[model samples]
Target: MRNIFIFIIFISMLFVSLSACQKEDEKLKGLVIESSSVEFGSLQNPEDRELHFRVQINDYGMESEQEYKVRFIIQDAHISDLIATEKIEVPETYKTQLLRNDEARTIVTGGSKEIKKDFTIDEIRKIIEKDEAVIIELYDKNRTIDREVVTTFAENIKPLVKVNPNAKLEHIKLKETNEIDIFSRAISDSNKEQGISYIAYPEYTFSLAEESYFLWVTENNGRIMNTKDTYTIYSLSDSSLKEVKEVIDKK
Candidate 1:
């Protein structure tokens, strides 16, 4: 008789565990995001630019009363600064089952939502520079599941260049040499319709003897052309411009 009572208790505990497992599966799962085009826009319309995308909520494993708050963001790829954002609320999915003459059919409602946002080229430029990437993401309020795409804003934007603070110019005194703004130079070339391909990347600018020059590192080698002397500077890695500065100091 005691054995029978113990068996009954064990069966009850197993049934309770199974019920708990089933209840845990009632959370919503699938949320997807899709976009028509990754490119923000072209340089043709410099004044106006727009971003378009879509968000989809799948009803396959969605819960009956589950609600989701979705957020869309356009952020800088290098720095996660928010450029633009939009929020949306998705209600619980409604489903209906119909049976007629031994035939059963299920109809699902509430799935996809279209999101369209208008932005300016200036807004994108403020976030990301030329040749740099921008990130567009769609995520739920929980931030657990997200979809993102990385794309460049425009090809015509000037590359971001700044003085290398870590660079040491021991050979030249500070008053004797001036810092050259390579970004402005690239913009000037672009304005002339000559394109900025010449000074796009891996380039260093320095002023020596009141003459500004650019040293371009190509094919693992950098060339600096001057009327006085031409220096062949080899770069071990393109990660830093300090090597270029070191060579200049040595010369």
Candidate 2:
């Protein structure tokens, strides 16, 4: 009788251990890193720049009853100095809510939920610009971790500048004129084909400030199209185009 009781107790303990392992395995069943790489275009200043990313975790075993936290670490000394050291957390309620949403369904395929957050890319650029090495580590709530490395190169670091083509046309006026000429050129070599080559000459009211008008010319088939360049000239003084204080064309 004593031997049988001892044997039963040992079996019970073994079963419990196996069950615990199974539960943990289930928690991480569909957990995966969707966009591990965080890209920050170019950092001209030391001000902090952040890049957002998503971590996809699938709960195949059971509904998420607890929230999960994620932490970030920069192992390299040079890289660490340039970036802010911080860890981000995702609440359980937030995860649960997303899991129940339709959009979350798209991120969590085969029974999973995706949690997205942003990280500092500016910090990484600062370190790299100085010819330093960067190591990025992402830690999950369950202690699972992932990392990536970025090396400093001449091609990888630069300044961020964009040409806003949607800028408003200044000094517009309506006049009866034939054959209005619109001049446009490609800013980049690759954009030579994709660049705007068409102009639109409206017969109605047609007058705009020289600064307000942006000539976007494009070539179609074998002929040049000018109608594409003609658009309702927006006012630079308006709130929509006010943020666009200026438009700079490379060519």
Name the best candidate (by lDDT): 1
Give the lDDT of residue 27 in candidate 2: 51
Would you estimate the TM-scores of all the predictions? 0.29, 0.28
lDDT of 2 by residue, 36-71 (tens): 333432244222233322344333322444333433
- List where candidate 2 sits over 4 angstroms from the true fold: 1-30, 41-63, 84-251
In the order shown, what is each candidate's alpha-carbon RMSD? 13.5, 15.7
What local lDDT does model 1 show for residue 35?
28
Candidate 1 lDDT by residue in tens digits, 1-251: 99999999999999999988776654323223332123332345432223332344343344333344443343444232232333222354233223456333332221222213323345455454443343333334555344444343333322222224466433322232222332223222321222222333324554554454444545454433221111112223332344444444544
> What is the alpha-carbon lDDT of model 1 when measured against the actual structure?
0.37
